[model samples]
Target: MKRFTKFVFKALVGFLALSLGLVLLFKFVPVPVTATMVMDGNGITKNWESLSNIDRNMVRAVIAAEDGKFCSHDGFDREAIEKAIERNAQGGRIRGGSTISQQTAKNVFLWQGGGYFRKGLEAYFTVLIEQIWGKRRIMEVYLNVAETGIGTYGAEAGAQRYFNKSAASLTPTEAARMAAALPQPKERSVVNPGGWLRRHGNTIAARIGSVSRDGLDSCIYE
Candidate 1:
């Protein structure tokens, strides 16, 4: 029992150290690819863009569509989590309450899944990123790595692939449409929007102004 406990303790310490080191390393190094991006096979069509070059409209639209309280929250959104839990209990279509930060951590450092072990590691990485990367870096990394469409990765690639334009030139409506497809990028076509996507994009477009007006996205600027 004593020997087993010692082994477990050493393993835990080693895991923590390795995880922390990786997180720290990524803070300075641009992530070239993610597990999902690799798994997709056709290869990622990402042209990395700096935050300033990626258009503020795209930023606002994404924040409004995905996480309204991104600038203020730590690693989790408690209210959103609570609401997701309640809605999931009622149960028709399952809902997810993962914040942008959590998604970023998972996308950059881990694979996609809902396993307990994955969730636990996601939580750990989320905390590490929130502490080490800061809001601006987190948002930047997310914009640069998020799987925007099938074989598409990052704002630049998504913009070019869907609109034949650069990410820096994305209009508010265009950005909103892109943001709308984020939840199910593979199935939702941003270029040729369906009824649901049109409505959802409109909703996100409407909310974008409020996110900026209320300074809900000010952290990136700070």
Candidate 2:
């Protein structure tokens, strides 16, 4: 029992230390190998570029698709988590209850994997980033690091490759499609832009109004 306690303590300390270090590092340095996937008969990786209007609308689109309760919670939303648990208990696809904050944490800090250990780390990192970074910054990093295509890494890269423009130039319709491609990024043909992609994109675009981007101004102060 004592040994187990010691191991847990050490792990917690290590996690805190690593999260603090990453936050400091990100503030000062652009990551060396940040990537985005693109299509030109074939897909390829390219550097990620941060954008100016990685704004409320874009953030809203992501929240609409991923986590709509971002602004209300501190780091985790217990109610939603419980609801997901209930759904899974009744036989669902085992969807996560992660918020945008959590997803950003995974994209920027943790590796891509589907396992208990990785998810635990993702949760730890998510909580840390939310407490340290503001909501806007969290969304910014998410937009810049999230995998958009088979190999695409950020919105800027996705924009240039998919729409032939900068991230800031993304229209509401385009942003909604990009946001919708997130959950099925690899299988959904984001880079290749196939028929299913167009169809799914349109579906997400139709629900854009429900996302409530401007309504989140309240959480801005939090």
Compare the candidates by lDDT and give the number of the best one.
1
lDDT of 2 by residue, 84-186 (tens): 8899899958877878888777666666557988888878777777777777677767777777776676777777778887777677777877888887667
- Quote the positional error of residue 8 for candidate 1 in Å: 2.7
Name the regions of candidate 2 deviating beyond 4 angstroms: 1-15, 33-46, 190-200, 210-214, 217-222
Cα lDDT of model 2 overall?
Answer: 0.70
State the local distance difference test value for candidate 1: 0.91
**In each prediction, how many residue pairs overlap at the backbone (N, C-alpha, C within less than 3 A)?**
0, 3
lDDT of 1 by residue, 1-222 (tens): 999999999999999999899889988888888999889877768888888889888999999999998998898999999999999999799898999999999999899878889988888899999999999889999999998998899999999999999999888899999999998989998988979889999999898889889998899865
Among these predictions, the greatest TM-score belongs to: 1
Q: Estimate each model's TM-score.
A: 0.95, 0.77
